[model samples]
Target: MDVLDFDLSDREFWAKPMVERRDAFDRLRARDTPAFFAEPVVDFAPQGPGYYALVKHADILEASRNPEVFSSGSGGATNIIDMPGEFAEYFGSMINMDDPRHARLRRIVSRAFTPKMIKQFEADVNTAAAKIVDDLLDAGPGCDFVAQVAARLPLKIICDMMGIAERDYQFVYDRSNVILGGFDPEYTGGDVSQVVPRLLNAGAELQQLVQDLASYRAEHPTNDLTSSLVNANIDGERLTLQELGSFFILLVVAGNETTRNAISYGLRLLTNNPDQRALWLEDIEGRAPGAVEEIVRLGSPVNFMRRKVTRDFEMNGHLYREEEKVVMFYWAANRDRSVFEDPDRFDITRSPNPHVGFGGPGPHFCLGAHLARREITVMFRELLRRVPGIEGGKPDRLYSSFINGIKRLECTF
Candidate 1:
C-alpha cells in the first residue's frame, strides 16, 4: 500500500499511539514547529493560528480555563471558509466568538435554556423518545440503532422545538445529514467548495425560518425559544436577521448533532463494554446518571475546538504572534492520562469526572449543558430499559475528522 493509504486505514501506525497523538503532530513538534494537530498522516498546517496539540490534562485544562491566554478569538485550525470571520458575518452565533461580545450573545440565548425551560422540554423529550422507541421496538430484532433511535429521536425533538411541520422534519433531517455528511460514509458527496455553498443554502433556509418566527413573535409572542430570541434586546439593540438566523442554526446544529452522536456512541460503548453495560442495567438509580457522564466523556463529540489568538503571548516557554491560531484537542484531552485514571477503560462507575466533554471554561461554557445532560441521561435511561439484549454490529462513523461522530450503527437487541 502507498504511504498515504497506510496512514488513513491504520490508526496505530503513529509515533506514540493513536489515542496519544498522531505522527504528523509529533513530527511538527519535533522540528520545533509552533503548533500541532491530529491527522491520519494528512499533514497540512490547518488554517488559523499556529498551535502545538495540547494532549495532557493540565495543558488542556489551562488552555480551556484561560480564554484571555488561549483565546477563541483567533479562530484556529479550521478549513478556509468556516473561519469565525465568515461565520460571524454569515451566521453570527456565539460559538464562533470570544468573550465580551460572546458573553452578551450567550446571555441572550441563555435565557431560553434556563432551569425551567429545560424542565418544560422534558415532557416533549419523553414523548418523542417514547414514540420513536415504540416504532423501533415493533420493527424488532435487528436494525440500524442510529437510524431507528439515536438519529431520529433528537431530530424529532429539535423539529418540535423549532415548530416545524411533520413533513418538514425529513427536510431538516436531509439538510443536517448533508452538513454532518462531512463525516461518515456519505449519502451524497462532493467538493467542499461546492458542498459548503449547499450547506450555506441549508443554513439560509434555517435563517429564513427564524426570520418568519421573529416576525411571528413581533405580531403574536409566545413561549418558544425562537419567540424569546426574536423579542430579546441586546444592549438596547434587537438581534438582526442574521443574528436570529445564526442562533437558530446553532440551535439545530448543537441540538441535533451532538445528542445524536452521544446516544449512538453511548449504545456502541455499552454494547462493546458488556461489563459496563451490566453495571448500568443492574444499578437502576445511581449508575444510570453515572453511565451518561461516562459515555459522554468517553465520546467527547466536538473533537477539536478552534480559537483565534487575539494577541501575542508566550506559553510554556514559546512565543506566539498575534492572530496565530490554537486548536484544543478534545479527544486526546478527554482521555488525558494525567486526569483520568484508567482513561482508556470504559468504567461506567467513574466519579470525580473532570473530563471536558463539553467545551472548556470561561464565557464559552455550553449554554445547553443542562438540557443536554438531561437529554442524554433520559435517553440512556429509556434505551437500556427497553433494548435489553442490545449488542454491537457495526458503527458507521462520520466522514469529517473535525466533527468525529457516528452516523449509523447497526445493533442487535
Candidate 2:
C-alpha cells in the first residue's frame, strides 16, 4: 500500500495486519512533516478540524513536554473529537485536564500512591500472580491466556485497591472492556452508531459502583484507595463523590487495560522470540527489570493520545496552528528507527530504552507506572518459574485504534 493510502482516523486501518500497521507508521515517520487526517465521525459528537499524526519519537516527546501549547484538556486526551459534556462525569480525570485543576487532582491522588501503598501492592501482586499460575496449572493448557492469566492480575490488583468486592469483579471487567473496546463488534455488538451509548452506559455503571463504595467508605474508611480518597488527608483535602467516581473509572480503565495488554503482548513476544525468553529464564529475577521495560516498549499498549494546540507553534521545524489537534502515536514512536536500534526487534537488554509505552515524559506521564512495572515484573517472574514452557497462540486482537489489546490468546504449556 502507498504511504498516502492509509488514514489514521479510519477504523478499518486498525483492523489491518500488524506488519501493514508498522509500515504505514514507518512511512509517516519518514515524512518531513506529520501527516494530517480527518477526524472519525462519531454519533455522539460533531466533527471538528482534523489532527496531525505525530508518529515520530521526537515529535511526541516535544508535544508531551509542552503541554501548555499542546493541550490535553481542550477537547479530551482520550478521543480525537471533543467529548460531550455528559461524558465528562465518566471520562474527565486529571489526564484530560490542565493545571491548576490537573495539578490539584494530581496532588490529591498522588497522596494515595505513596511508597507504603506501592510496597503493600507489591505483596498483593505476588500472591495474586502465584494463584493465577496455580489455577492455570490445574486447568492445564489450551485456555485463553488473556482471560485466565494476563487480565486477572491487573483486574484483581485494581479492584482490590479500590476495595471492590469479588462478586463485582466480572461486572467491572466487562464495563472496562466496553470503555476501551473501541469499534470491536464483540464489545459494541457490531453497531458503530451504538458506540456512544455503550461507552456512556459503561462509564455510568462503573461510576455508580465506585460511588456506592465511596459512600460506604466515607462513613467507615479502610486502608484501600477509596478510603483514602473519600476521607480527608493530612491537609484535609478530599475527593467529592463525582471526583472519586471519575477517578476510579480512569484508574480502572488505564491501570487495568494498559498492564493487561502489556502482559499479553509480553507472552506473544516471548513465544516469538525464544532466545529472549531463554535469556530471561537464565536469571529471572536479575533480568526482570530489563525484560519488563522491553515488553512495555514493544507492546506500546495504550496506543495514541490526542492533544489540541493551544496556540500557533512551531515544533521540529513544522508549524502547528492554534486550535489544531495532534495525536501522539506511542506505538509508532516506540518503534522509531531514529531512537530504537533495530526498531522492531524485542531485545530484553536494550539499555537506555526511552520508549513511551507509559506515555511520554510530562505531567501526564502514567501515575501508576511504578506499580505497573512491579506487576509486570512479578507476574512474569511467576510465569517463568512455574509455567516456563508456556506459549501463547495467535492473538485475537482487539479492533481499536486507541488500544493495542489482545481480547483472547489461546495458551499451551
Considering every candidate listed, which one attains the maximal TM-score?
A: 2
What total of clashing residue pairs does each candidate reach? 18, 0
Q: Residue 382 CA error for candidate 1 (Å)?
A: 1.2
For model 1 the TM-score comes to: 0.85
Each model's lDDT:
0.67, 0.92
Candidate 1 residue 165 Cα shift, in angstroms, is 2.8
Cα error of candidate 2 at position 275, Å: 0.4
lDDT per residue (tens digit) for residues 111-179 in model 1 = 777888889889988878778778888988678887888877777777677666677777777776666
lDDT (Cα) of model 1 = 0.67
Which segments of model 2 are wrong by more than 4 Å?
A: 1-3, 234-236
Alpha carbon lDDT at 294, candidate 2: 94
Root-mean-square deviation (CA) per prediction:
4.6, 1.3
lDDT of 2 by residue, 89-170 (tens): 8889989999888988899998657666798778789999999999999888999999999999999999999999999999
Segments in model 1 whose C-alpha atoms lie over 4 Å from true places: 1-50, 75-89, 183-188, 234-237
